[model samples]
Target chain A: MKPTPTPDFDKNHPDRAAANLATHAHALFAIASEHIDSDTLRRLRAARSDALSAPRRRNLLPVLVPAGALAAAVLALAVVWHPLHAPSTAPATAGTGAMLVSADSSEVDMAQNLDFYDWLATQPQPASAASAQ
Target chain B: MNLAAVPQHSEGLVAARAPELPVTLETFLAQVQRRAFRVAEMGLGNVDDALDAVQDAMLRLHQHYRQHPAQEWSPLFWGILRRRITDLQRRRKVRSIVVGWLGSVGDDGEGGPVWEPADPLADPAREIAGRAAYADLARAVRALPRRQREAFMLRVLEGLDVADTARAMGCSDGSVKTHLSRAMEALRHKLEDWK
Candidate 1:
């Protein structure tokens, strides 16, 4: 319910110019408020009280915020770790994987290039290494 | 400041230490709530909606900004309540638009508005007339456009200074003055007999 602006309230605002309609408007609003029935005011007050107490019923900012942050952090960790901390692949690359599985570190001759191996295969069996060492 | 940078405000909003609000807060709310409801009703034209707006504003002030200095509460609460009233007005406008579109249109358009003067019996050349003059005044206030009505209520009725009203309205000081002036003119023309 609206209240009629009381004479005291109007008088209290001495700073306001007397010529303005604020005083009259205040007075009118005060009258309007006075006309409101009691039951309506009670309902409004009840609503206000309920709102004041709503945080206890469900304050999302407390629990939901931390929970949401934790969930997001877990999601981000999954994304980062999936790429960086994954288990070492069996062989990593196609060529490396095939050769590494079939061969060993000792079998992989360091100086033996694949191009040299092809050229040697094309030659006449290296001429028995020139008939002697 | 970007609000996302700090989540601590949530603590202030949710866990409002009742002690933080000064003793004036309760008295201030109790005193202002009725007038706020009336002002809201003038803007909304619906008692139920006006009640909700006032209650919401009270809760908002109590929960979020009650910790602010008591002196600043009037303008702050009025500003917040004004915004709430405008929000409801916008929602009602949207609903009305939808309904108007669905419903059939008429050429006379409800046969125009009725702007009758205040009931003569309610007035007798006093500093203030009885209930009828006030009723006429309220009717005229309601007849003004949304901005004009808000300006009248906030700047004049609420006694908020131009700057405070502007802050509440989220407008420039110049705009507030303009609205107030226009509202005064409109109200004076309609409510000339009251004066």
Candidate 2:
């Protein structure tokens, strides 16, 4: 298909002088574009060949470097934050006072005291202690 | 049909249909390189910088949009070139300022393209007159605001339509018209004495 015609200053319009000037200037530009020096032409040819032969993917190192660094920084922050803010899983044990105990140790202690608690339950409490309780 | 005959017939068909196919990247680049250079030269007013800009634009188009449809190449290529020219212009301005502050002489000379007559026996008087006229036109164009110059060159010299010129300029079609109108008015006044 033919391309759309470029809009030009109308010859029959009031600005005939401008139309004429555009026409003249276009012709001159055509000439100038064609009459490039041999050296410049050679350079242009080399440039074209280089462009065509070169890889399609641009060197994204500049962009990728910063992007990669940002991603790494975010990952580091996440790693640090998870440990600092994650909920504690250790079992809460009453009567342990201010001492912190691991879940396994707390469970073991409860098992060892089971027999003693059972024996104590079988014995009756003193009257004064019962009244205080 | 014999196998040889089949192959030959298909080859003939392919050859016949070649012209109807979309333009390849190399062909597109070859077609626009010169005119692109000229436009760059006009914008930057330096030969080496213009050539660099054209080369950079060609590389960018090849790298980024080589796989696009052929019909999209013109606008894409011109748009890339226009941006490259603007970039070079900005760099030159910054360099000039820095050089001035350092008390160093900057190379702001216009190393324009060398023009030669196509016909060796062409009339010297006519050739000289044409050259003078072209020089004047180039000067006037360079003096225009960046947008106006871009609009004038793309729309007038390169013969790109309003839509393509708008795409190339990264602006609205209405803005292209306004800039072109102002450019023409300015050029007419500037070249009033030219016959």
Candidate 3:
């Protein structure tokens, strides 16, 4: 004999289905919670602490060398250019022709003015009356 | 020299400034680690790989948490973890391709087959019937589309509310509801035997 096909209970009783589902879900959750391992919990605690502390000690070694080199190059250029570009120490000695002669010394001459030489060199040259041979 | 005097002033200024900020990575990890592990495990279907994904996600979170907002940390962490799991899936696919190309290596044959975890609640006639029903339910859940699976896990397993689940999943609450509804329908069909 052909068995009567089961009615679609979900159509007639949605609330009943939902309540059962919720109950089953709650039971599943309770079971799953019991299986939570203490070791896993400890490991999780460690991972979190590591995550927080790791940034404080973060050393991006991959980028450090290139960044350091670039910074050093910039700093060296600044050091070299600073004295040469600064305003001269005294205005009275500004136009003296001896400034350029002393500018070649590698040793820093605190008393001598490299800026005066730089200023002097930057000035527009006089229109030469005679052509150079 | 004034230059020598400048160092002291700078040092004093630094001391007077606020202390280094205490990042809450540890605290956040304590809250999310287990759920993250479970989510990863469900997504990848491998405990060791899931653990690795969780660790990698935690490390990445640590790396970025300083710049990330305090309130958005949970969502941001979950997003990073999801990405890590995706990466792991891609890597597994590549490994499979490589293995297939290489004609495969011999298994170590040491460890036993994938151990079936016996449901502790699987006993007695009523419980046995429940177990079979639950098995069908689990299979239905496992068969869900990726987004639906994620939505269900976030909303149901993690017990996150709709707004929070939406934030974590990077979707609207409506999307969460849609995914959840589809998941529920699929499970309901599979779980009809439970009636």
Candidate 4:
């Protein structure tokens, strides 16, 4: 017949078991520490430094950086494209006429352009009058 | 001076004015390198990986010592070494995120941890015997699962308390407890068999 496991070695005995194990475990660690040498330690430090620094030591920024910059540039262009390319709010016909009026502000030029101004002044009255009545 | 000469002179000036730091980088390595290596070896099983991990941690320590206080180096070294070991465990496929999560959720709350402080100098004979026992324990510890081994070495061998071990291992106190408990169980079974 197979031997039945002892119930006495249950949770209650964990403390005693742990203590005994620790005692032996501690001894094992000391012996291992003794086998280790200064040179081995020095070598480990060197290897650790190399491994930790591997992620940062690089020269790929030039190749990788431009792609990110191009993406950002594209995104920026997309955001501003609509605002920049949208047509002006001014009445399309008024823009060229206003540019012409502003270009020559001399008394003689204004006197010559009085008809254009008069026509512009007359254009807005119809919209305002329609709104009022 | 010519533009080239001016640039050269500035470089020379910066080099001349550089701090004669009390702890030279090489000297610092010489000071803490071995202990750090031993800590790494004990914390992470597999001497080869431990060596690599310790070297990596030492390099980081050397690279950053100027930014940190000298006294804080030990804990910082441990913190970094633990990170390296975790990375190694990940690469070796010995530990999975699922296992770590399960271990964390299973910790028993004893209101405090079970590992206690014992006097090292008070009992020389006992200390010697304990040291021998620790050697065997270290091998058993190395055989444990990565998380359990980490918790065991950090809390027990490195003499770090639970909170410190938790910080080093990047896990909860509960997780540390669970790992430690499992580690203790494995050690007991293995040691009993060996004796």
Candidate 5:
């Protein structure tokens, strides 16, 4: 007599067949786990710890970096705007011109040429006279 | 300098963000490490290679994708492991091919088979039938082709859903199904007496 054909238990269901195979495969996998003995397991754990620690250390940089940038930006804004607004109570010796000269070295050259500018102011009627005529 | 003096970084924020971060990652890696190593062993057929693959995968996942949501960790880590295992498998294949070529030159019976592992089942040692059968199963699974092994491990052993397995293996759902079916059929045939 002919035997009956087995039903398609795994048909239309991939994981079913996979599950069956896994069921069969699990025992050997367990044995294989045993083969991954203590020393190996320890190393694997150490590897995990090593791997874990690296990212945490790396993560510190990102946190520190953005915060550091924010602080630097805030400090810079304060330094720049501090003398600009000056609370109207800054020392008279620390005049805005002197502050500008300190803030920009180019202003030192302008300040140093102030005497020349004053002499020129007393002597510069040539161009204005020609234009007036 | 004063930036260093006050320490501009938010110590509180760092403490808040960091404490929770690696805990989940470490848990995930710890949970999966053994099984991942097992799967790699199945693929590579050697403990060292398998552990290397596992460690590389772990490092890659931690270094690259730790910030992904916890739920996404499974697929991402598996995906990385899949790639690492595949890469190592390819490199092994190339090395074996070169070795085979060199061996073929002498054409002597000196070197044994390069692919097949030693039969641990040969020595029974009064072990249980289940253990012996498991040895056979591991050998059989290792004997399977690379794609079939990957499909089997991911879809079956790892219990990833088809979509997740597909994502992990970098293949289409249909391809995953096909490979998994072929793997199951092959394993069933090879391990017919296990039941």
Candidate 6:
């Protein structure tokens, strides 16, 4: 294509020069765009077809993200709360003396021996007992 | 304000509310693809990259905004193309930087492949001149700041109105005018010899 003739504009006039430039540049660009090689045009056509046929990205991220975050928070809370509030297998020592019931027989014997000691203390010492000690 | 009392304004509101005539997405893409490719080419300075950017823009528009009003497709498509071009340009910049740092000779950093126009003119001399002119213009355009290049291409070459150009560039109308003015001034100086 013949390049568009540069318009007759005063070279010193900025406005006219700009107008001529816009016109000339636009013409050139239009020619270039319209006369794209057949190979490139074919590629462009194929690209368009591919774009149309390509599956739309099902952006589930927007919906899934918040839900996933929420689920994670709930799971973490469950994890934390379970250990804190779970029923204990060990005996409760807060209000009941039931803990002593589960103790070894030796501990029970020790408790019984405490009563014998108390009785021994209560027995007043005789004058003979005192001299023998 | 009693909206019903303003008949003209009410009519305009009703018109605005009226559903736009349906234009198929395929038709819209076809209509803008060539011009979009040109715009991308101008911005990217490489034909293949330009084509890639255009295709990417088309796919994104189809994927995300197919349900939008047809009247809005022009700005939306152009906006997508503009962003895609920016991304490609940025990638090229980073690649050039990496290539330079690595001391690789593969990329000369001298503006990747040049586009050779397929001129069918019987007069070889005229064809050469035409190609030279186009090359000169493209070079000057590529030299522009990113915003100015976008404004010039969208406003002048692609012939988008100020509003649509602003939308495509993600700027205000006044900003578009400012960018376009600066671009023109720059081009005027660079292309003075052509005039």
Strongest candidate by lDDT: 2
> What are the root-mean-square deviations of the candidates from the true structure over C-alphas?
14.4, 14.7, 20.6, 21.2, 18.0, 14.0
Greater DockQ among 1 and 2 belongs to 2
TM-score-based ranking, best first? 2, 6, 1, 5, 3, 4
- DockQ of all predictions against the true structure, Cα-based: 0.12, 0.18, 0.07, 0.10, 0.11, 0.18
Compared with the true structure, all predictions reach lDDT values of 0.64, 0.72, 0.59, 0.57, 0.67, 0.72
The parts of candidate 1 lying over 4 Å away from their true place are A1-20, A56-133, B1-24, B105-129
Candidate 1: TM of chain A?
0.39
Q: For model 6 chain A, where is the 10-residue window of minimal lDDT?
A: A1-10
> In angstroms, how far off is A19's CA in candidate 1?
2.3
Ranking by DockQ: 2, 6, 1, 5, 4, 3
| Model 3 C-alpha lDDT per residue in residues B53-121, reported as the tens digit of each score | 888888887775656666667667777786787788788777667655454453654433233333422
As for candidate 6, its interface RMSD to one decimal place is 14.0
Ten-residue region with minimum lDDT total, candidate 1 chain A: A1-10
lDDT of predicted model 5: 0.67
What is the C-alpha lDDT profile of model 6 across B1-195, one tens digit per residue? 111211232221211223333479998788678878877777776778878999999899989988888888888888899999899888877776775665545555565433333222222123222566667777789889999899888877776667888998999987887787788878988877775
Scored against the native two-chain complex, candidate 4 gets a DockQ of 0.10
**DockQ, prediction 6:** 0.18
Write the number of the candidate with greater lDDT, choosing between 1 and 6: 6
- Model 5 spans > 4 angstroms off: A1-20, A27-35, A55-133, B1-23, B103-129
Question: Which segments of model 3 are wrong by more than 4 Å?
Answer: A1-19, A56-133, B1-24, B66-70, B104-139
After superposition, the stretches of candidate 2 with alpha carbons farther than 4 Å from their true spots are A1-7, A58-88, A91-133, B1-22, B104-129
TM-score of chain B of each: 0.71, 0.76, 0.64, 0.55, 0.74, 0.75
Candidate 5 C-alpha lDDT tens digits along B1-195: 011211223222211222122358888888789888877776766667778888888888888787888877887888888888889878878877877777777657586547644343343223333455555666787788878788777766666667878888888987887786677778878866543
The DockQ value obtained for model 2 is 0.18
| Cα-based lDDT at residue B92, candidate 6 | 79
Q: On residues A18-130, what C-alpha lDDT tens digit does candidate 4 reach at each position?
A: 64344334334433454455566456656645644554443467988999999999999999896677667645656656667657567648766779999898875677778
